[model samples]
Target: MATQQSTGSTLTRAWANTALPTLGAILAVALWWLVTVALHIDPFFVPSPADVLDAFMRDPGFMMNETWVTFSRVLIGFGIAVAGGLLIAVLLAASWTVERMTMPLLAAINAVPKVALAPLLLVWMGFGNSPKIVMVVLVSFFPVIVSTMAGLTSTPADLRELGRSLSASWWQTFVKVRLPWALPQIFVGIKVATPLAIIGAVIGEVVSPDHGLGSVIVGSGSSADTPLAFAALVLLAITGVVLFYLIVAIERLLVPWAAAIAS
Candidate 1:
């Protein structure tokens, strides 16, 4: 009986969470439609919700193809950023001296407006996916490195002492205690980087304007097809939301305790 009640409670909470956000989105969309209809806005300037829908339905295949191009670039770039960032974070956490020497340089590089590099990347890498992927990496890499290092270095004193009392070596202590503790923080970083990855991909696409959703947006705007441009923007927004939720889902699976503790 207790187990059944607990399951029911979980389901209730899940439904509430999902239902609330869905309701809010519906309300927002309704408001948007109402405003567009009442304001007599020009479709070429600010398209109504129906106009955007019509544009999307007009050439869904083309839109989906462009979406795939952008999505692939984001995935490739984000994947590389995750792998490389974690490795570099581990290396830095292993040595204070190395971190001190390297972090400043990384910060300096990160501080440079990433958008400025897009043109240079295009000039060097040409009109290909390589520059877009690299742009995503550059944008998303810093958060992971910073967050992972914080988690790794912030392992509880008690845990470290327990490891030492067990006669555990440095490797054993890090692998068993520090890494597990750091998983939550590492995931936080990854979540933060997700949107940045999308921004980077779009920026790269904007600079080249040859393929991807960004190119569609550019072409539409030039042709004064505001509804089509809005469609691209809507697609990009949906893509970002999906990617972020996917990361959250992975984080819940891997570090369920983090959520429990926070709540």
Candidate 2:
């Protein structure tokens, strides 16, 4: 009975969290519809909800193709970013000296906006997927490295003491104590990085890409097709939301205890 009630409570809370946002979005759409339909606003400036939906419906195949192109780039870039981040994170965790030396440089690089490098990257790396992948790696790496280091470094004092009493070697201490403790923090970085990776992909497309939501957006904006532009924006939003929830799901599966604690 208690278990049943607890499950019901969880469901209720989840529904409550989701319901308000859904309603709010519906209300916003309704308001947009009213403003576009009643106020006689220019369609190019403020497209009606129908116009955007029509654009989406009209070009389903094109959207899919562009989505595929963008998705491919995002996945490739995101993959390299994750791999490189993990390597650097491990290296930093292994050596404080390396961490210190790299910290200032990393900070400086992160401070410098990466989008500014796009044109130069295009020039050097050409208009191929290479520059886009490299941009995503550059954008996504810092957060992953920083988050992972934070997580890997956050071993519980009690666990460290226990490991010391057991005369555990450094490897044993990390494997037995620190790594588990760090997963939540590492996932925190992933949650941050996922959207950034998506954005990085879109931005890369903006500078130069044959197809993608960003290119769709750029194309529409040039022709003053607000409805199509909005459609691309909606798709981009969907992509980010989907990616975020997927990360959250993976985190829950991998760190059930931590997820439960948060809940």
**Number of the top-ranking candidate, with TM-score as the measure:** 1
Best by lDDT: 1
Model 2 lDDT tens row, 100-199: 9997888799888999988988999888678777888778878988899999887878888999999999999888778788889988998899888888
Write down the lDDT of every candidate, Cα atoms only. Answer: 0.93, 0.85
Segments in model 1 whose C-alpha atoms lie over 4 Å from true places: 1-8
Candidate 2 runs further than 4 Å off:
1-21
TM-score of 2: 0.90
How well does each candidate superpose onto the true structure, as a TM-score?
Answer: 0.95, 0.90
**Backbone clash count for every predicted candidate, in the order shown:** 0, 0
Candidate 1 at 224: error in angstroms?
Answer: 0.9
Clashing pairs in 2: none
